[model samples]
Target: MTSAEASAELRFDPPGPGSYKQDPVHFPRAATRYWAETHPPAFARGTADFASTYGMLLGGLQTAYVNGIAYIVTLPAPEEEVPQRFQRAEEAMTGKLWREQLREWDEICKPESIARHRELQSIDPDALSDEELAGYLTRCRDHHSAMITQHMRFTASAVVPTGDFLAHVGDWTDLPPAELLGLMRGASPVSAGASAELERLIAALRQDTSAQALLASDDDPGDVLAALRDLDGDAGAAVSDYLDLVGNRLLDGFDICEPTALEMPDALLRAIRTAVDASDEADDVDARVAEVRDKVPAEHREQFDELLGEARLLYRLRDERGVFSDIWASGIMRRAALGAGRRLAAAGRIHEPEHIVDATLDEMCALLAGAASPSADELAARAAYRATHTAKDAPPTLGPPPPPPPDDSKLPPMVARLMRATGMALGALFGSSEAEHEEHLLRGLAASPGVYEGTARLVSGPAEFGRIVKGDVLVTVSTTEAFNILLPLLGGIVTDSGGLLSHSAIVAREYGIPGVVGTREGTTRIADGARVRVDGAAGEVTVLA
Candidate 1:
């Protein structure tokens, strides 16, 4: 069925009695039954954890899926907890609370999460018996849920300080968020796809003539990668180590339906090549920091320094939370599901193994246990529907219009400060201030500060990433932090969705590339391979050709 027909057939009712907004940033495409079941509760619980820890007025965010598209609503805290929340907010403004949370993330939360993911990743799902595989699926589902919650629990700690800096810094200078955010260039090494494994591999390749020759060979990309992984030396060991670290991680998106890095061998190989050949260049970060600092008034300059430092300290957590959490766990889940699908396909139970991803967890378990209630055709149809529908097919809002935000003016000063900081940060984090532009110009949020002209490569998903040559501008609906692994191929980034603080924007800034995000019609209006000029400082994309 067509997307419009599919939209008409599906119900758009609110899961509960509140306004629900579409979360296109995360779920721009339809979610599978597996993801629909696992993500909502985990998201709600995680948001609650962040809210309770930060003493926010809201209880948490609740999620609902309509026609497979994700929607979210915010819940309010109970009246009785107002006094306690005020006290917590006052303490939060002192910045001591988030600092402790940051320390916890670094010392405890991060290590435990990594350990759990490693344990799960080590298990070979294909080696398990039927019953053992069923149990393993359950375990993977549970772990994926926990990681989602873990990702959410740190949301406040990750964004609040950065938001606090933006809120305070905006008051002292007229610099746009794009310029101010440049100070965060070196803060998140992971956002630029930096890992110790990748560094070691690069070093090994640089020193080994044979490995470098193999990498430069005109052989099949997959065979090339396999040979590199099997090479008998430090270069080969480094290649294996790097693949073990990221091979199973999703190339884009959080859902299990998304393809992992190893699944896209050509793109992954190209990324490795880009990383190996990349030259280190000096960034004007220190100069930009000094310029922005001079704009801050004399008395608040010291406070400005403190806020900037805090923001930079916690900045890595924003992407790291998702990267180390559900992104890795979700890929593991996908691997198990695909393994099950392979068995089912071999038994002639399903038309294709990938169709298993569309099955609900219960259905997946039942199919594994030899129960055939859901026919293979049904799963195929579901997969087809999910693949065809995009976020544009769904309504932007479901149920009644949302209630206005509470007036912070009547609240205590500290409480108001807390609310403002959090609100401003999140608003800028996901919001775009683009206005309608002329036919040739696509307006958007000035995500990164630079100018570049290049061929626009319109990529709808990770599958098309192989078409991207180095220096091509990437035009997409949106990007997750996972896409940072491929940022080396792009000279600029233009997305149809996301704002200044979106992952596309963050990675572009960290990688020192031009980025114009939230250009509502970039992919549709700017033809693929069209020559385009991206003015990231002015937030405009001119279709030069």
Candidate 2:
């Protein structure tokens, strides 16, 4: 196919579930290019292995997102025979398989891929010959595809068995699925590291008058980081290391459409400042886990112990999976596109470096090769179109939507368990919606369990993230893994999209903050700086002042 045809084809998603535009705060050209071309096909292909090893229920659909961020997949209810398949799959969830995957990732996949990404990140696109640049593009695609395969495989193995355990627990348990999962996941390395880093900075600033003065000033965060570095010791080193770790991370929900924490040092600095002053303590999550364990009846206690142990083992991987995933690879692609765009701009080929996002990878290759490609005017117009595009521009359902799952009452007890297990998985992936109202209280999925009241800070996108203050409630479209570093600064969290298992929910629970997720339009409906109360257990956020 021609480059344009190939680019258009990349936008195509199979007819199953509806795909919506995520990361609407900014126009996502490069991110869309990656998803449309790479992510989906790789994910779908990996699901084949999952289905072969697990059951049809676990393999019903790989994912449903077309070309945006945070899309979910839901499959039609299975026939009666499917439960037996699920049962066999549940039986195979032993420590053996999980261990093997972990071993492979540690021994082979992770180290190699990370090294490659770091190498690519260091390369100057302008220094490469056109062929070399094209070769980097190819490397980015291959590495991204490999990472997706690993993630999907690992996730498929983890989610299914965990779902089986939850199915065994039933919805009538003492804690909800998301909360229990959070407890199992514990404080992720990302969140805990962030909290500890801030604490370190705070402690250092207490002793260093010069550092304290830097904090008091209204200097840019990057400038603040620089000033801290000038202290020529741990404080500067701390800021430097933290920025390096978080810079290229997927901050606005797993897509390259938005900048990473490193790219926005000011926001990270503000979040650290907020965290230093906050009084929130880590919740006694272990005690909560013990309480839930005590709630299990004697008859099922043995099995519960087995499953819970395994769940906890696999749980920490939830956040870490993204760390090892292809987002780094995607970042490489984005950097290359931006670099190429800059060169093109210098040559008067494109109006700006960012307009490269509007072109396909092939078109970009062509531009780098001094071949025919989209004109600067065309790319600029495409960028303009993306900026104005909103989720409303997307059709609710693309093609015929998949049939809904059958009612719970119609199935046998084991089958019913399987259905509920899958339902919980799907629910956590796809957010719930409640009827809209004029009342100030907004309803959503109960993610983390707590109640918090604070001034609401509506952050529309990355640019507005610096506005968040200590004790402020964060209001946004959604967050990605990178925001884990800043979750401690918020009094509570609310989102326009995401299910209980969303990044927001998981991070809030880990940090012991109140959170209401999947409020379809929380960003639009909740006014910035309004006093709001988030009742996480009740899944509601009420604007009180």
Best by TM-score: 1
Give lDDT tens digits, candidate 1, residues 417-527. 778878977886678655997989989999988899999999998878889999999999999988888899899999988888889999999999999999888888999
Among residues 3 or more apart in sequence or in different chains, the pairs in candidate 2 whose N, CA or C atoms overlap within 3 Å are: 247-262, 253-480
Candidate models: Cα lDDT each = 0.89, 0.66
User: What would the per-residue lDDT of candidate 2 be over residues 1-545, giving only the tens digit for each residue?
Assistant: 44334345454454454432233322222335545556667876666555545544544344444444224354432466476665654544533355566667668876787777677777877898778887887676677787777666666545544666666665437556765665554635554334354557777766777777887788877888777767867777666555555556655654445566666787777766765566656566678767777888878888888767765666555556666576566566667767777888888989998888667778888888887568888888766654544443453445454556667687555445544655666457555557464588898878877899999999866667778777799998767665676666788999877786667777887777788888887887899989999998888899998
TM-score of each: 0.98, 0.82
Instruction: Tell me the lDDT of model 1 at 171.
Output: 86
In model 1, the Cα lDDT at residue 402 comes to 84
In candidate 2, position 196 carries an lDDT of 50
